[model samples]
Target: MPYTLIKSSNPEDFVLVHRFLMQAIQRLRAAGIPLWEPEDVSVDALVKAYGTHSLYLVMDNEKTIGGVFVLEEDALFWPEIVTNDSFFFHKLVIGDDFITKGIGHRVLDALVELAKSHGKHWLRCDCHGDRPRLRNFYESFGFYFIDRKTVEGFDAARYEYPCL
Candidate 1:
């Protein structure tokens, strides 16, 4: 399946993205995956992030299947790496209907390409430290486990993929 990631500045897109995130949060909670909280994702917060981050809507041809945010710098999660040599991925939410269809893997591949196009050396992201399945998912995508850290009251497992 071909996925198109469009950098959207539209307010409607923000709402759609927020909806997708909240849906994923609910699914995760039901599955006992303590990842994202409702407060962690809101339309207002996403709107604020739009000014500083690249918010993308993942499209599967005509349908919007997911969304993600790309940040040039993520000092809060990765304070030790004080450099813009990487693209930080956040809020990668795929619709429930699209899960397990290899859409997430394809999205990661697209993100890695996007990072390489921007001359970034690596693509980085963090997930709940205790989610082994999620961590394994990233690891399966060629992302190496960096370290686990408690940042801003969230315990996160950082991972980085070489954009070579």
Candidate 2:
């Protein structure tokens, strides 16, 4: 389905984003995706995400299918990995029923487009390094896996997508 890319302006938007993430986690469990196991994504954390970063909501006409938070270079939580001044994708996923429904890709592609239009040469994101499926997902879209780095026991993958 076609989706509209929207920037969420406040913590209230995270209430909707959190619901989508909860659904995504459920779907990942049902699908047996191991690294998708996130025990508690508290509203406080979600609210923090909204306050510190740029939240992009993926909507298909009338529904909020998914969302991802992007923080520009120099924002907090950005480890100095690849030094090209790139955008970052944090908390990226879709609702449970929305998974396998092609919504996540739509939002990501939109972010890539946004980056390229702004003359950004790279788009970077990190995730659980144990998730090879997610690695493949990012790779298929041209995001190259740079390395496996750990922060607080969560193995993280540093992915870089070069602009075309």
TM-score of each candidate? 0.92, 0.82
Model 2 lDDT on a 0 to 1 scale: 0.72
Q: What is the C-alpha lDDT of each candidate?
A: 0.85, 0.72
lDDT of each residue in 75-140, candidate 1, tens digit only: 788777887789998889998877765778999988988899899999999998988888999999
Question: How many clashes does the backbone of model 2 have?
Answer: 1
Which residue pairs in candidate 1 collide?
none
Q: What is the C-alpha RMSD of each candidate to the true structure, in Å?
A: 1.6, 2.8
The clash number for model 1 is 0
After TM-score superposition, what is the CA distance of residue 81 in candidate 2 from its true location, in Å?
A: 5.2
Which digits, one per residue and each the tens of the lDDT, describe model 2 over residues 95-132? Answer: 76666645556677888887787778778888888888
